[model samples]
Every structure is written in C-alpha cells, then in structure tokens.
Target: MMKTILLIVTNIEQYASGHLKTGLWLSELTHIYHAAKEKGWKITIASPKGGNTPIDPESLKPLVLDGISKSYYENPVFMNELAQTKSLDMVKNDSFDCIYLAGGHATMYDFPDNTTLQEILRDQYESNKMVAAICHGVGGLLNVRLSDGEYMIKGKAVTGFDWFEETLARRKNEVPFNLEAALKERNVHYRKAFIPMTSNVVVDGSLITGQNPFSSKEMAKVVVSELEKQAFM
Candidate 1:
C-alpha cells in the first residue's frame, strides 16, 4: 500500500497589520511534497477553512524561491491543491501515515487556536502516527493536547522558527507572539540551528520538526526514512 501524508496549510492571507502580505511559504510545502512524491506516497493538502489558501509573496522572491518550489508554482495541477483545500472537518475521519504542517508567517495568526486542527493532531499523535511541522507551521502543534490532557510536545525535543530568525526577518514585533518562547512554555526541549537560517531538524519518537524553511527537505527525508524503516519491520 502507498503511504499517505496529510499536509495541513494555513488559510490566513496576511498578517495582523493588514498591510504586510503573508501566507503559505512555498518551499515549506513543495520541498516536502516533492520528497514524499519521490517515494510514491499519496499526499493530500488541507487547511482550517477548506478553500483558497494563499501563498506568501515574500517566498516568491528571486533570492528566496528555489528551483523546485518555482517549478511547483508553475505547475497548474500542484497549485490547484492550494486553490481547493479541504476543511479540517472534511478529513477528520481519514487515516494517514503522517501529518505535516507547512509554514509561513500567516500560520502564526491562525494555526494555534483552531480546535479542529488540535483534534486532528491529537488523533494522529496519540495513535503513534508521524506528526511533522516546519517553521511557523509549528504553531499548529502548540495547542495540541493528548487525551490525557498533556501537551503533545511536552518534554519532547523539537525545533521550529526561533526568535532570532524572526528578528532577522524583521517581523519580530509584527508577529503576535514569540514562537520559541511559546514552545518552551509548553515544556518542550526546543532546539534550533546554531548559525540560524540553516537546516535543523529534530526527531523525538514519532514527532518530527524543522527549524525553518531551509530545514524542510531534511525534515521530509527523515519522515520518509522512518516510514521506510517501519515498512520493513
């Protein structure tokens, strides 16, 4: 059977300022999508609201957009997934081998409070299935509590977009809260790339996370490797 991945994307199109545009970080999704695609895995893109997810304009810049992400941007079929995302409720009963949360500044605004997202994550996590997130998408993991009422990431080693990176991005003050601090408060052994803006991934059991956009490819590779390992077991 083909392995399945449920990719959760954010629906928010802009930051709270309303002037600075923000949405899904293209590479964050494309990198993982292509990696899983290479393994012949089935991928489904869904969101909190069900339709029309936006792409962050910053991610499309020449300096930031990689060839792989650009290719997906140009591919009509792949882009269409963002145009018609299934709502969280739509996939509540679906089973997937892994659940990945793609990131962007927009995720900081919407990913944390969605009860539906929390429920889905709780289900996937407590079931011992793989759960992964990158950059600001880690926000989605913030509020996910297990059936025992403990935060899923509590005491687990994880990594995500850190405060320094947010400061470097010049959106430190614009963001609603400090993600690194939030993770720490949840009792997670939070980690990040020493040099910043580098590929950093942390896997603690079934939960996997990446520190930033640069970490997506490696994160996806880890997910695939773990799944493949289990396949032969």
Candidate 2:
C-alpha cells in the first residue's frame, strides 16, 4: 500500500488586525505534494472547517510564484481538492503515515486552539508517524500534548517565523501572540536563521519545522527524506 500524508491548511482571513491569509503557501504544499507523489505516496488536504480554501494574494506575486506553485493554482483538479478539503472530524486518526502543516499568517487564528487538530497531532506523535510543520503552521503544534501529558515540542529544538521576521513583515503587532516568546516560555529549544526571514529548517526527531515561507521546500524535502528512511528501517 502506498503511504499517505495529510496536509492541513489555514481557514482564517485576518489573524490579529491585518490580513490573516488563508490556505497553504502554494510552494509549501506543491513541494511536498510532488515529492510524495514521486515516492507513490497519496496526499490529502484538510482544513479546520473544510471547503473553499482562500489563497493569499501576496503569495501569488510573480517573484514568489514558481512554476509548480503557479500550476497548482491554475489546476482545476488541485483547486477542487483544496476547495473540498476533508474535515478533521471525519478523518481517522491512524489513516495517514505522516502529517504536514503548511503555513500562512492566517494560521495563527485557527491552527492554535483547535482541539481536533491537537488530537490529530497527539495521535500522530504517539504513533511515531512523521509530523512536520512550516512557517506559521508551526503554531498548530503549540498546544498539542502527548498521551503522557507532556508538551510535544517541549525541549525539542524547533524553528518557525521569528519575532524579528514578523517585525520586518510589519505584522508584529497583528499576530495574536508572539510565537517565539510563547515557545521560549514553554521551554522549547528555539533556533532561527542568522538573518531575518531566511530559510531555516530544523529536524528534531520526527518533528520537523521550517522557519518561514522560504524554507517550505527544504522542509518538505527533509520530511520526505525522513519518511523514506523510516520506511526502510
């Protein structure tokens, strides 16, 4: 049987006061989707509420939109899949071999405090399934706790969109809370790139994280590599 992976997208529009930017960063999902497809892995997309994932207008910029991402945006079948994403309530806990959370500013609103998502991550982590997240999607992992009552990311070396990057993006005051500060308060071994908003990917055990949008492709590559290694192990 082919391995299956689940990708979660954000549904909120405005996170704090600025634009929330829903849906997965196009490159984020495309990179992983194509890689997993090459490996014969089936990929499924889901959202908190499901149905009609809205694309971030800024991500559609020519500079940011690559061929794969552009094609994904134009593909009817892919767009339909994104439109009718599976609901978290309907998905079985162990149906997938891995779970990936794609990032966007909108994720800060819905990814955190989602009990259903928390359950999914908890189940995947306990099952030793690959659990990966990129950019703001890492916010989803913020509240997930293992069966033993331990925080999933506690003491784990992780990286996500840092405060400095947020400041540079002019969204520092818009987000619900400072993710880096929240992670640090939880005792997570947080790390970041030397420069603000640079590509930084971290793999601590089965948990993989990427710093920002630039790191999405690399993050997906790392996840696919890890999954391949685990398959042969």
Per TM-score, the best of the predicted structures is 1
Model 1 has an lDDT value of 0.92
lDDT of 1 by residue, 143-200 (tens): 9999999999999999999999998999987899999999999999988888999999
**Candidate whose lDDT is highest:** 1
- For model 2, the stretches where C-alpha displacement exceeds 4 angstroms are 16-23
lDDT of 2 by residue, 111-196 (tens): 88999999999999888888899888999999999988989999999998899888887878677888888878778999999988
Task: Return the TM-score for each candidate structure.
Answer: 0.98, 0.94
- Give Cα-based local distance difference scores for all models: 0.92, 0.84
- Model 2 clash count equals 3
Q: Flag clash pairs in model 1.
A: none
Candidate 1 ranges with C-alpha deviation above 4 Å: none
